[model samples]
Target: MTNTQIVIAELPSDSLTPAHFKQTTADMPVAGDGQVLLKVILMSIDAANRSWMKGATYRAAVNAGDAMPTYAICEVVESNSDRLAVGDIAASEATWSNFVVADAHKCEKLPKVPQLSNLMSVYGIAGKTAYHGLISVGQPVAGETVLVSAAAGSVGGYVGQIAKALGCRVVGIAGGAEKCKWVTEELGFDACIDYRAPGMSKALRAACPDGVDVYFDNVGGTVLEAALFAMNEKGRIVCCGAVSQYDTETPTGPRNLPGLVVVKRLRMEGFIVMDWTQNDAKALRALQTWVDAGQIKVTEDIVDGLENAPQALIGLLAGENKGKRMVRVAADPS
Candidate 1:
């Protein structure tokens, strides 16, 4: 059997584009001991994929000549382990490819549910990341003012709604008018400021009159710097992602960090969602309740074809995707 895959083309440098990847064909790997062969159904394009190319951050590097790193939903074609069965739908950290040979230890069967696609969009990595960062790290309380950067994106969108559920006044900073409208009118954010607008600092100041108590940062650059200036006493900064500086040679950082942390007694923390895996079941149950009752919403920007995976990732890094970036490789029989 043949498999189509994308692999790192050369040593990575700053400002990655689709050209950094090269498409190739290879013989399919047979399922070996304690392994499963998965037919790729769909995959996610995430900011972490960009970091994987430039050495390692919180994990090992993706060596050149290896498959491009990605998180994907897969269907079990064959299995050599007792934990998984053939035909089970599972999620795994796989390659940007048509098929993958993964350790059965690495794949987990997805819960059978109505609206499986919707579940994947909202309750998968994006949703889980938001929940873990907000509840576990930020520890937001009622009546506090919460601010989120990248407010229209996957994790940010979920963070806004979840914060509101806890009775916090939510303000968001997105890129444009449309996203600001979506966050405020549709997602129930108290107010969402467009970071692209002139006088963004003034806008943020006006939107957050009482100062920001909890800040969820996804696209950390100058936006974070602005948030730092507006932080309240004992505020919390949850460093979820830094998409804005992902491909930069020298990533810019917050300049006002010193005074804010010292004067405000702020607790700023960064986390990887995978570290909190033991608590996922509880988070998922709560997320399910919110999603079922229309308290949370989901959005996806899907691109079709395995061949277009590189381009999809490019769009994700460029902030072209309106929500979670997804690539549909094959039809889901379920």
Candidate 2:
């Protein structure tokens, strides 16, 4: 009967930072027709969550005072729909709560990973976001040089690995030396540039000496401008999520966008991961197979308790999280 949830309310103007989630409890909802009750396991702490907390952007503005928009992996505790049953593991949009009542249609049965605690990580929304953008937009060919910004983050990491698997040379651009080292040494990027370094444009040029063919952009401000100058003719740029400017009070618009797309005859497209909903199943299957075969790695930074969800979410925007950030709401013994 206990239901613990993380809620964000309007606080005093100046004190209302991203670290403002409050924990409260209420009576848990029972399963209804076409619904299933989920014992929340893992919830994503994403840069996107920070935007949602602010309540202005198109994606972040889920109706005022509604549960936050988050994807979580849960175990079915009760089911009124035949599609799911007790003990089935699934991924659903449960936000930041210990228990959730979700529509059966929105839940996807998870592939059981005996040794893994968060299969929903690489096989979840973050993985699918990378798969869809890289495959659909990047369309990388063998021997091409591909570039990725926010290279050490969730979707960016996947994009680099997938591109490398497809035979392209991958170059990653991250903000720090440690991240740059991981991108090159661990993720197998052919080169990794520290964007925070002096003369970053020169560093980027040196990394992609042969010219970039596919650019997967996660941090859009100055890095995007630099990418424009470095791309080869007919290059493709897949604009995923822009974490760099997500926290500013006023939105920071792109500066060299038009010229960048024009002179180089490049094709740049921006897309939301939800737009690829039709390909969700295929993407999940591919990611799962890759994980099983050791072809890809799923990195996660998890924080315990729903109470820490707000801080974890804030950490994501500030680039404090190394991989897919998550909040573990309840311990699922099953």
Candidate 3:
């Protein structure tokens, strides 16, 4: 049978653009010992894809001539391992493709949950990353005011909700008015500021009048600067992502970082989800419980077809996605 894959043929030295991807065809691989064949169901698009565009030298997780790296929900079509069944749904990091041959050891059994659809979302890696970043780094406490950048994004969305659940007053910073509304009304953020508006610093200051105890940063660069200025004494800053600089060839440096940290005695930390790989299943279960109880909300933008993968990735960098950006390579034939 024929198999299709998205390959990164040319290296992208600058920003990651869709033009870097090259689609190709190949023969499907047969199931090997301790491996399972999966029909791709859904795959996520994240800024990390951009890092892989430079090839594997810097990021060992991805390489040239290799399939684009992604996190996906898949259906096992064939299994040589005893743990997985033909119809079982599993989540794995299997870039862009219609079929995947994954080591049985690498797959995670998707647990049954109330909002099953959100298991691939709020209970997914993105959700867990947000949760851990906020709690482990931001360390919000009851009555503390937490501020989050890109508050409408998948990670930011969870950060806001998690803080609110922890009894902290939450403020969100997004690019537009609609997202600002969702931050306050839907996600229960105490307030939201539109970063694109004039006087963003002044607005953020006013909205966070009590100062920011925790700052979950999804969009770095200028937003980081603004958050630094408004941080409360001894505040904690979580460096979740630098999305604001993803599309630029030359990323802007944060000029006010030293002042913010030294003057306020603030603490800032950066973490990758893989650091908690050992705790994924544990975190997933906790997030799933929250979703089952309607305590956390997840949104996903799904683009159909493997052919759309390149553009789907491009859309993510352009801020076209409201939540977890994903590509749907196939619908359940059943």
Candidate 4:
């Protein structure tokens, strides 16, 4: 069978446009020497996916003539390994292609849930990332003022809700007026500041008159700078993905760093959720509890087809997606 994949057609200098990627179809590779063949179900699109196209960081870049790197939910259709089976479902850090063949080491078996689509999103990497950032790093307390940047987006949405459920006064920073309304009205944030507004710092200050006790940041640069200035003494800053500066060749970071961290006595930590793998089960259980009690909700923007995966990633980097951004490669098996 032919497998279609989105591959890097040209190297991007600063930002990505449609021209940087191309769709290619080739015969599906066979599982060999302890490898398994996977059928892609759905793929998560992330801002970091942009960085991968640019070359060299924690994960190497997908240069010209290379398949884009991505994470996916898949079914193990054929296995040559003792660990994985034909019917097993898994989460993998594989390239963005219709089908993948790799050893068991790169894939992790997923938990069986009644609703795989919805539950996979919550129990997947996004949920775990939110848990590690909010509970592990931020550790928000009741009555504290919590501010979230990119608050209407996937991980940001969860950060605000979880902080609110902890009894903290939650405020969010999103791009547009519509997202701001949804964040406050539907997502339960006390208020949301449109960072795209004229006076962002002033608006955020008004939203959190008491000063921010916790700041869960997704988009960095100017937003991080603004949040830093709004932070109360000893406030916790959870550094998740920095979407704003991801596209730049020489990505500039937040200014006034010491003025906030040293003067404010802030505890700012950058984290990769995968580092906290041991706590994955605990975090998943907590997420399920909150979801069951109606304290947590999962929202997503899912696009269909492997051919449109490049556009999904493109839109994701441009802040076009409202919730957790994903692309459905095939119909989820019933």
TM-score list, all predictions: 0.96, 0.91, 0.91, 0.96
Question: Where's the lowest-lDDT run of ten residues in candidate 1?
Answer: 111-120
Q: Residue 198, candidate 4: how far off, in angstroms?
A: 0.6
Candidate 4 residue-wise lDDT at 126: 77
Ranking by TM-score: 4, 1, 3, 2
Which is the better candidate, 3 or 4, if ranked by TM-score?
Answer: 4
Q: Give the alpha carbon lDDT tens digit for every residue of 178-210 in model 1.
A: 879987988899999998889999999999999
Ten-residue region with minimum lDDT total, candidate 2:
10-19
Model 1: lDDT to the true structure? 0.87
Clash list (residue pairs), candidate 1: none
Candidate 4 versus the native: TM-score?
A: 0.96
* Stronger candidate by lDDT (1 vs 4): 1
Candidate 1 regions with alpha-carbon error over 4 angstroms: none
lDDT of 2 at 206: 87
Off-target runs (Cα >4 Å) in candidate 3 are: 55-64, 112-116, 277-289, 332-334
Ranking by lDDT: 1, 4, 3, 2
Local distance difference test, each candidate: 0.87, 0.80, 0.82, 0.85
Model 3 whole-model lDDT (C-alpha atoms): 0.82
User: What would the per-residue lDDT of candidate 3 be over residues 131-195, giving only the tens digit for each residue?
Assistant: 78987777889999999988888788888888887788899999889889977888888899999
Q: Where does model 4 exceed 4 Å of error? A: none
- List the candidate 2 regions with Cα displacement exceeding 4 Å: 11-19, 54-60, 115-118, 280-285, 288-293
Error of 3 at 296 (Å): 2.3
